[model samples]
Target: MQEFAKKPTAHRHPLPHGTLTLTTNASSMVMCAVLEQDTDDCCQLLAFFGKKLTSVEQKYSAFDRELLEVHRTIHHFHHMLEGRQFVMQRDHQPLVRSFAKTADAWSAQQQHHLSAIAEHSCTIKHLKVEPLPTSEEYRYLFTIINRSTRWPKAQPIWQQKAESCMKALIGWVSRHGVPYIITSSSWGVNFMSTLWNSLADNLGAKIIHTTAYSPEANGIIKRLHRSLKASLTARFQGGIWRKELPLVLLGLKTSPHTALNISPAEALYGQSLTLPADTFQHTMSPASPSDNRKAFERIMPAKATYHIARKVYIPNELQNAEYAFIWVDAHRIPPHSPDYLGS
Candidate 1:
C-alpha cells in the first residue's frame, strides 16, 4: 500500500529537465494511471492514481475505458504539464491511434475523452501485450452443454480477459442460431465496427442501444439477474457463489415463467425439459387453463334484434284508385276535446 506524497494541484511548477510520460491501463472494474519523469536508467513516479469504475462505467468497451484513463490522467496533472509536451502510453491499439485516425463511430464519452486529449499536443504509443488465452483450456471443462441444455455455460468466465468476451459470444452463436437482435447499453465494445459488421452481414442481426438510466427498458433481463442472485444466495455462501452459478442458471431456465406460461427451455426448444423424476409413462402435458367465456367471445354471434314498423294515414286520394282516405289521430286529438280539426 505504498502512497505517493506529491498531489496534483492547480498551481504551476518548474518544468522537468527530461521527458514526462503518462502511462495508463483500464479494466472492467478499475482504471490505473501513473505519471513519471523518465531518466537515463529508470523512471521516477510523480503522481499515481487508481479509481474504481461505477456500474455504468464498467460496461464501457476496452477502447473507451482506455481513452477515459488518458483523459483523467491529463486532467489530474494539468498544472504540471500545461505547456510542456508529453507522451501518452496505452495498451489498446485503437485508442493509441484514435487521434491519428478518424473515429466517426466513437461513442459520446470516447469523443469527449479524445477532445480533452487534443487540447494538449502529445504523442501516443501502444503497449505490446501477450497473447490471450483461447477456448482450448475451457473445452475440457463444461460438458453439460452437450448433455443438457445444448447451450453454453451460463456463468461468467473465471479470469476473464479482454478477448474472452468475443470468444464467449462466438461460442454461443455456434450453439444457438443467430439471434434477431441484441440490446445493450452504449458500451464501447457494443459499438466495435469489426464485431458488428460481421454480425450484420452473417446473421442479419443488429445491436440496439438501450436508453441510459432506464433499467425498465430491459426489465426481463434484470428480473432474470435478480432471480439468479436469489437462487445462488439460497444455495451457496461467500466464495461458493461462482461455483454454483451454473446450477442456479439451469434451474431458472427449466422453471416456468408466469407471464409466458412456459419455461424458457420449452419456449426455445419447443419441448418441456425432462427431469430425473419419471420416465416413458407418456405423461400428458396439462393444457393452459384459459377461460372458455373469454375464448368464445371472438366467434359468438352478435345479439339478435327485432325491428317494428309503424303505420301512418293521410287524407289524400290515390293516383290509380278513386278512393280517399281520412287520417284520424284518436290518441292525440282525444274524443273529449272541444275543438278538434278533422281532414
Candidate 2:
C-alpha cells in the first residue's frame, strides 16, 4: 500500500523481467487509472491520471467509456509500453471480448481513439473483483484537486485583456490559428478591459496570467529576451538595435531550441524554414544524372522512414510532378496591395 501511494520515478534502465500493469475505471463522466510494474510478486505503482469526460463523451455507454479509459491510460504511458507487451486490467468484463472482436459497431470517435491504443502491443485482462483501493483513492484525489483549483471561468484565452492586447492576440489567432494558451502579465493593461469579454464571446482560448513582478514565472522568455538583447548589443555595437532586430529575431527563430529539439519556427510551422545556409549547399555545381540516381537510392529509405514517422502522405502525382506551385495567402504577400510595392 505504501509503495502504491509513492509516485513512480522514471526507470533509469529497462526492466529485463517485469510486466507493466494498467488498471482503469470509469463512472458517470469521470475516468481514472493506476499504472504499475510487477516483477517477482512485487508491484510498484508507476503513475496515475484522472479526467472528467467532455459533454460528447458523456453520451457514451458505460462499456464504451470503460474502453475509453483503457485507451487513455495506454496513451498516457505509451513510452514505457511501446515495443513491449503489457497487461491491461479492467473492471469491465465485456471489454475483454469486445476489444478482441472486430470494431465494426464502434462509434467513429471511439474507433479513432481505440485505433491509436491498438497499435501498442498489449493484452487486456478482465478483473473479476471490484475497483482497487488505489484507483478509488485516485478518483477521490482527482475530484478534490479539480474542485480546489481555481479553474478559469472564461471560455477563451483572450477573455480578459486590454483592447490593444486583445487586438494583437486576435491578429495572432487570425494568422496562426488559436494557440493552446495565452500567457500574459497581470497588469492594468491586461486585466481591465472590455475587449477581453469580446474575446471570450468570440474565440475560446485558455488564458493564463503571471503573478506581477514574478520573474521566475516566465523565466525562459525573459532569459531569451535578455540573450537577444545582449547578442544585438554585441553584433550591432553603436548601430540602432531596432533596425537590426528583425534579422536577429529571424536567426533566433531558425536556430534550434535546446529543450524542444527543434527550432521555434519549426515548432510553429511543423517544418524548418529555408535559411541562407540551406541555399549555400545549392551554390555548388549540379550532380550528373548517374550521381543523382545513386544519391536518391541512398536517401530513399531514410526519406520513406521520415514520412512514415511524421504521418505525412504524398500522392503519386505530386511526388512525380516536375513543378509544384505552393499557393501563398494574399494577406501574407508583401505590400498587401500590389500597387504599394511601386509596381
Candidate 3:
C-alpha cells in the first residue's frame, strides 16, 4: 500500500460586502418569511408596520384611527396566511408608548384580538426614519427576522394607559402561560418596568424586560409573525376580515410546528385533538386485564349451585310421599305373613 502525503490547506475567505449577517440590530422593522424546505407551494405572510401617523385633527386623533387600521390589517393578514407561518416587526419604543397612553378604551373584540397577538414573544426597539442625504427619497430603518425556531406568533398591543395595559397583559398571562421574557425599546422601558413591578402580585409570573431598541433579541417571535401574515394573506383573498379571523386562527393551531415537528395543540395537550368531520370515528379496545375481564363477565350469566341443590330435594320428597318406616327387633318369631306378625 502506498501512503499519500498531506497537502497544504487553503484559508477560508471573509464574507463579501452586502452579505447578510445574523447579528443585525433589532431597533428597526424586520420582515421574515416562513417557507417549507421541500417546496414553496405553501407560503405565509407577516409584516410589522411601525410608521407613526401624524394628523392635524388632534393629539390623540391619530391614535384611534391608526390603531384601528393596525387591527384591521392584522385581521386581514391572518386570513391571507391561512395555514403557514410568518413574522412581523414593529418599533418597540413608540409602539409600547402608544399602548401605554391610549389603549384603555378598546372594545371587547379588539381586546381579544390584541390579547391573542400579545401571547407571542416579541422585542422592543427604536425605529428612526430619516430623509435621504441628497435624493427626495426617505431612509427607513427597521429590523427583519427569519426562522424564529423557539418563539412564534407575536402580537403588538398599544394602549395609552399603563394600568389598562397591565390589566390586559395579566389577563393574557392568565389565559396563556407566561413568555420567556418581555422585550421593548427605550420608550417601552418605563412601561415594562412598571408592568414588571406588579407582575408577581398581579400576574403571578416574573417578566424580564429586554434592552431598548434591540428587537433581534426576540427574533424568533418576529419571524413567526412574518410567516403567519404571509400565509394569511395568500389564503384569504377579498374575504371579510371579521368572518375569516377565527378560521385563520384555527389553521394556525392545527398546523404543525416546524421546530417540534408537531402541532401546537398536540404539544400543549399531550394528545392530538380531533376536529369536526363526519367521517372521523374512534374505536378503543380494553387495555387492562380487569377491563377485559369485566367485558367478558358482562356477556355471561351468573351461576347458582345453591338453587340447583334445593331443586333436586323437591323431586325426592314428591316420589317418597306415601312411604312410611317402622323399627323391628331381630328376635321376631312369626315371619310368614305381614298381618299375623304385626298382630
Candidate 4:
C-alpha cells in the first residue's frame, strides 16, 4: 500500500487514460464499495469504502438501500470520480432503472440522493453480483431463491436435516428478505421436522412439499442445480471450486434464463451485470478464434449434454447484430417450443 501510494504516477490522483469501475454490494446490515482502474489483464484497486447502516436505514427496501449505498459511495470519492464518466457495478437491479428514469418518478428521498450523486457520476455502466457464501465449513449448499424473479442464492450448511435446514433458510431470508412460499422435496428431515414447522409458523411462509423423488414438482431449483453443476464442471478443471461458486452464481443471475427473456438480476432490480466479455480488451493470448468461442461457451448456463440441442458459434461479424438466426431440429423441438444454444 505504501509503495503504491508513493509511486508518483499511481492513482493518488485519477489517471487521464484509464476507465474507473466502481463496484458495490449491500448486505442486510451493511454496504461496501471498491473503486478500481481498468487494466489490460484486470482491475487495479484504487480505494475501498464500508459502512454499517443505521436502524432506520436498514429498513429501506432492497432497491432503495442499494441505491443509497451507491449514492453515498460515489460522493465519498467525488473528487476523483467527478467528470470521469465511469462504470458502476452493484449487487441489486433497481439502481439501473432508477437512474434511467426521470426525477418525476422518484420520491423526495430518492431525489435527494440523486442530487448528491449528480456531480460525482453522470454516465454509468452497471453490473450486478449476488453474494454466494460457500459450504466449505458446513459441507452442504442449501439453495433458496425469490421464485418470482428467479433470483437464486445458496448457503453452506452442515447437514440436510431439520436444524441445518432451518439455519440455512434463515440465512437466506435474512439477507434476501422473506418468501411468501417455499417449495421443496418431500425429504423426511425437512418435511417432518418440528423445527421446520416452527420456522414456517413464525415467518408466515407456506411450505409446499413435492412428491418423493419427483424433481418436476420443484422444477425451478432443479434447473438451478443443473446450471450450478454445469458451471462447476467448467471451473473444476483448475482453481478453488469453493471460491468459484460466487462467479458461477453471477453468471446464472446475469445470463438470460430460457424461461424469462431477461436475466434474474434484471428481473429483480431493473439492473444489468457487466459480463467478462464486456470488459475483455482482447482475446486470450495464443488461443484461436474457435478455441476462444469454446472457452466462453463453458460459462453459458445450459450445457449441451443437458438436452438434445445444437450449439451455434456466432461469427464476429454478427456479434452486434440486432438478431441472428438459430436452427432448431424439428424432431427434437416441438411446435411452439423452439430451443437452441449460443456461444
lDDT by residue for model 4 (39-140), tens: 677667788899999989987988778878988888898888877778887646567767667659777888898778765655555564333333355456
lDDT for 227 in candidate 4 is 83
**TM-score of each prediction:** 0.36, 0.34, 0.34, 0.41
Could you give candidate 3's per-residue lDDT for residues 73-168 as a string of tens digits? 455445443333323334334444544455477766557646654543322234454322221221211221112222233223233345545655
Report lDDT (CA) for all predictions: 0.61, 0.60, 0.41, 0.72
**Model 3 — TM-score against the truth?**
0.34
Report the C-alpha lDDT of model 2 over 1-343, residue by residue, as the tens digit. Answer: 6686587666434475678888888966699987788877678767777999998888787777887788887778788788998888876878887767864887787788778878988888888853212221121100000111111111112222365456555655665566556555455454435567458546876666765545555444454655565666655644444455556767776776654445656555545578876887746586798976664443211110111122347788987877766543235545553433221
* Per-residue accuracy of model 1 over 1-343 as CA lDDT, tens digit each: 1244355443223336868888888866798887877778766677778999998887776776777778887888898878888888877887766788864986677778788789896888887854223342331121113112222245355443324455555666787756666554444453444655565457677767655545555444555555765785677654445566667777876786654445657555656567655475688776554643443333222222223233446435555666544443234545666443533
In candidate 1, the residue pairs with backbone N, CA or C atoms under 3 Å apart (3 or more residues apart, or in different chains) clash, namely 61-188
In terms of TM-score, which candidate is stronger, 2 or 4?
A: 4
lDDT at residue 79 of model 1 (Cα atoms): 88
Model 4 TM-score (2 dp): 0.41
Number of residue pairs clashing in candidate 1, backbone atoms closer than 3 angstroms, sequence gap of 3 or more or interchain = 1
In model 3, where do residues sit more than 4 Å from their true spots?
Answer: 1-164, 176-196, 235-240, 276-343
Better of 1 and 2 by TM-score: 1
For model 1, the stretches where C-alpha displacement exceeds 4 angstroms are: 1-153, 159-162, 188-202, 279-343
Candidate 1 to truth, TM: 0.36
